[model samples]
Target chain A: MLIPHPLLGPRDAQEFTYLGDAALLARPDGMAEGALGAFIDYVYLRDNPAGVHRELWFHEQGDRSWLVVTRNTVTHEIIDAQLARDVALARKGAVA
Target chain B: MRFSGFRVIKEALTGHKGWQPLWRNPDPKPAYDYVIVGGGGHGLATAYYLANTFRKARIAVLEKGWLGSGNIGRNTTIIRSNYGLPGNQPFYEFSMKLWEGLEQEFNFNAMVSQRGILNLIHTDAQRDAYRRRGNAMLFSGADAELLDRDRVRDMCPWLNFDNARFPIKGGLMQRRAGTARHDGVAWGYARGADRAGVDLIQNCEVTGFRIEEGRIRGVETSRGYIAAAKVGVAVAGSTSRVMEKAGLRLPIESHVLQAFVSEGLKPLIPGVITFGAGHFYVSQSDKGGLVFGGDIDGYNSYAQRGNMPVIEDVIEGGMALMPMIGRARLLRVWGGIMDMSMDGSPIIDRTPVEGLYLNAGWCYGGFKATPASGYSFAHLLATDTPHETARHFRLDRFARGHVIDEKGMGAQPNLH
Candidate 1:
């Protein structure tokens, strides 16, 4: 399902670097450090393990509200994504 | 006995102690020229103005319950005339003017404390919207002052001006907007209308309308069928049920709006403060209790008791504004049904049925519009044509796409 981004931003694609079938972690910037690492940890906890599939993400450094990145589960290639609070809240509930 | 002042005091005391009925109707007229349904503030004000202004003495205001028992007694009682839309600005301003003169005209104490109303802006979009609304109010000859953070701090010191989550940037303040005793307003108009020879009928519920050849012949009430040349339906929340009896349906949806009051403190809230980011507003009553309310309950419910979610949201907003109020215990909470239209404004015009007029769909802001509603409704009942101030609130405006949507919510509840 296509969900509209609550925040305004440009979409980006990243190659999904899957760690495992239960838990797959893909970095949109391919660089994990400090606050970004903290955000990734939050995302992981928010979107807990499920069957790997297509996922979109967005980097919210500009506004610190949302992020945009897309991923494909079959090939582990991200298509498009953006940072949105509703998405964050939804995914967090799912993962929890 | 050289006691001149004492004699004057004695005479004044005797006049104040004049005989009046405690609850029963002192005088009941079999027929009146104009019969207004719903003896709330709007209905009583209509009767008062009709008897005083139009010289229509044979007027009767029918109330199913005691006067002020409905939403008039249940509202938060915040009065403001800071309307942004053209259709609303003039009418509310007129009502504000009437509020100023109500005490003298009715010989009743309304306790209208003009402590000012401030709408806080938490985001850039909200600030921009308030700026536009301030300009509109100023252009329309209404008082709307824009205040920055420093100014807000100077005005209200208790507010969390530097909170990062919802920083207080600025606000649109109307110094004329304040609150009055809600029950006092109802009783003031009732006593004034009663003194002016208007039959104040209590416990007379209008069950249906007697329509003949598309014109309202009279109303069928629990007491009896009262004949009337004209009838005005000022029943706010129960508008749909009253209209349904006339074989008509309105574009109004009914929902219960809840309000709560906290235990009395020394003095915390100086004036009415509204959170523009959320649907929360608060003012302090004369009894020292903090009176506050949020938006209406989302779903359609005739039940007056509201759920816990709304109460929690309202208190959360309050705590966000004033953390000091966290210690203040909630004393009481109550709910009143609101007949919300598709738009947030009201409908004050003649219905398609002849001799049947409506002054309902006030949403949550009906208390502030009491005087102007009475004035315009009286004018409509006196003459068939609606006053220029109330012409935009026609019943057919919704179907014609001529909606006066002030909040721009269309038909949504959260937008207001």
Candidate 2:
């Protein structure tokens, strides 16, 4: 599969390491109320949907940037690809 | 009717019209004491065990499609209990025992060949790991044999023993573990369950669960709403989607695991063999076809197909292990959706939703664990207690830091 990276051009999926579900970036606080429960859900439970899924793929052999590739799980069609760092920073700014 | 030599002869004499259907294609009833979603091997086996062993009244299995249309029919069919972890060894060994007696107990030819399975060791550390795994197998009352390099050479002399990349050192063999007729297991269990007064409803996809106050009332299916006191789900790869209808998210990801079979040639591979340097396993079928598979697609996907990269990678592993296989013609390639769990093991436990039990996350190992998973899940549904062998396979094990990480790959579903 050819994964289109935000920085680098389209690259083969073999060059990237797959880490499922981009929701992983929204890790809950480890020192808050019901932290254990939230952490458990974060680390364990997954919304493994059959439709569109935002997943984290590290272009380890190429740009070394983690890309949040929004792809359809059933069809394998990539709808969008963006730098995961940019998405995380945007989320932080929104929280601020 | 019981299948026998006399029956076959009599049918032959009577123009071969006396044979009966394997299992009844019954319609779903309005209510049942127990309702199982997914008519795959585990679901059918669960229904059979619930009726025959647990003596549960009013049991029904609802299948989204025809039986054995899922991973039950799409696997390399290798069965072994050579696990190293305390939580997994005994459980898989229990499954091995059930596999041994499945054909006789269910009165069907599942082709439970006990040719044995060998996991090759390429490194000194791998040898130590195999030694520990073999010891764990022995501790679980399962057969295990640690074979030296010469012994492995004796078993399969054609293997690439002199390969510089993966030198043959030793292997761990389980004489009782081997392949079976994958689809035959499903048919046998379905027939057994049907004969025992359990309903097998096909084409009845479960759309959602009917929850009343905290307990599960029944399931909303493609056919219609069917009421039941308890509902068990064993939809191998569709575990996540099916459970989501009840607002439950599982610690499971769906990944495509591809299997390949070569064109029929002369008898080659004697038994199941696995490469130690990479993730690839192979066994020759009775049809003289080499049945083999390797790692998943390395991504979360509900698609029952894989990319070409994994296919090329698997063939590379095969060629590295046995250069002789390069001449063989690739005949068929198929993929099965694997319900990969975080710990690389399975989860057969009660969910937070009362009366809604789960038997999922079998990953690549689900096909081999068919019988035991059914039996254990039946025990759970009948008595509301975890089976002794599978007590460690709890849904909360990940949260409690009790993950059954046999490969030590740590939380990555794709890697597992």
Chain B TM-score list for all models: 0.94, 0.99
Tens-place lDDT per residue, model 1, B176-260, is 9999988889888888787778888988999999999999889999998898889999998888778888876666656678999
TM-score winner among the candidates? Answer: 2
In terms of lDDT, the best-performing candidate is 2
Docking class of 2: high
The model with the greatest DockQ is 2
Q: Which residue pairs clash within candidate 2?
A: none
Tell me the DockQ of each model, to 2 decimals. 0.02, 0.88
Quote the RMSD, in angstroms, for model 2.
1.0
TM-scores of all candidate predictions against the true structure: 0.78, 0.99
Candidate 1 lDDT at B413 equals 33
Candidate 2 wrongly placed segments (more than 4 Å): none
Looking at model 2, residue A15 earns an lDDT score of 97
Q: lDDT by residue for model 2 over B283-312, one digit each (tens)? A: 999999999888999898888899999999
